[model samples]
Target: MSQVTDQLAQFVVFILDQERFALPVEQARGIERWRTPTRIPGTAAAIMGIINQRGVLLTAVDMRVILGMKPITPTRRSRFLLVHEQIDCAIAVDQVLDMLQLDLSLAEPTPHRGTVASRGLLPTPFGFATWLDLAALLGSINNG
Candidate 1:
């Protein structure tokens, strides 16, 4: 489970394939309007390719591919959820719902068999959000 504290933690809540997901605010750099990324040859399926966000190059990872969900076409509603880490990257999401402050103490521990991105499952008024372990997720994609 995510670390439970007395105070609330803010998360960037986004939707993918009609399901809710959360990324810790600290790990989320910023959200940008979906820019068409330049494709690279012989890259992994999940890697949409590299994008230059204000001159800084970043790998564009398809969240749907990473999470094993159906792929979606880029639309006006699409956005890039930038992730701050050792090497910055961006995740393509269907929609960004809102930012939420939730009590992780209410989070439920999931089995290790859960998806690679899951840090835990948090219940929001909207629905359950699978909190992301972004470092693990990005590293796994890089290392895999």
Candidate 2:
């Protein structure tokens, strides 16, 4: 007899710097094609700026820059991953490859994964999490 099993994970997998990473789906809004963002003043280097997604202002954050990697200059291929965490709204990524349903049973804390050691962020058994402070991210927006 063959066995079938179901897997569960609370995150959405994304691509950045040609690497596979994940973020909590609870906070994810959706993904969009590349669009020029209106840069904000006096914000962290990682903060790309504001973008209008269907009339909603989304703060487009460059994941590479947030991860301490060199930022990619905006390109036609660039995309945005809209997410909201503890605030009205915010953006968390520059590009997305695909949405993956991670299996928590096969998942391990990022810190425990030597292959992903270079990635500063860590994933809980359920999914990957950002060390970026929510207050700090929200504060960047005049109103989030």
Candidate 3:
């Protein structure tokens, strides 16, 4: 069998503005509705604040701000994806789209000029989704 056909991975797709983005499903702990996170005084600009999930504290990052897009008021569809990489954190998104199973080989390296947090881009039937590089994203947050 073809290598592409033999390798599959799942992704959690979400929306930011009108664009779609995704992260590997294994990296996400869970998805929850928007909650007001307590503001931290010295956090990065992209860090929205921190929210307590169950007993754990999760730093919330605003994806729109990180992507250089204007922020929009949260709607009923707004959600937070709890992701774990070098750190455990959450990112706000306009909406949680869907879970997709795709061939691993379909991921194309993101162009050098592309978003810093994007490791690659995946083309779907609906459109293209940027594949988030959680480690890079967390590093950017830390360095900022």
- On TM-score, the candidate that comes out on top is 1
Ordering by lDDT? 1, 3, 2
Model 2 regions lying over 4 Å from their true place: 1-7, 88-94, 112-144
Check candidate 1 and list the clashing pairs. Answer: none
How high a TM-score does candidate 3 get?
0.87
Model 3: CA > 4 A from native: 1-5, 113-117
* lDDT for residue 76 in candidate 3, whole number 0-100: 95
How much is the lDDT of residue 131 in candidate 2?
Answer: 30
The better candidate by lDDT, 1 or 2, is 1
Compared with the true structure, all predictions reach lDDT values of 0.83, 0.57, 0.79
- Order of candidate numbers by TM-score, starting with the best: 1, 3, 2
Better of 1 and 3 by TM-score: 1
Which has the better TM-score: candidate 1, or candidate 2? 1
Per-residue error (Å), model 1, residue 66: 1.4
The prediction achieving the highest lDDT against the true structure is 1
Clashing pairs in 3: none
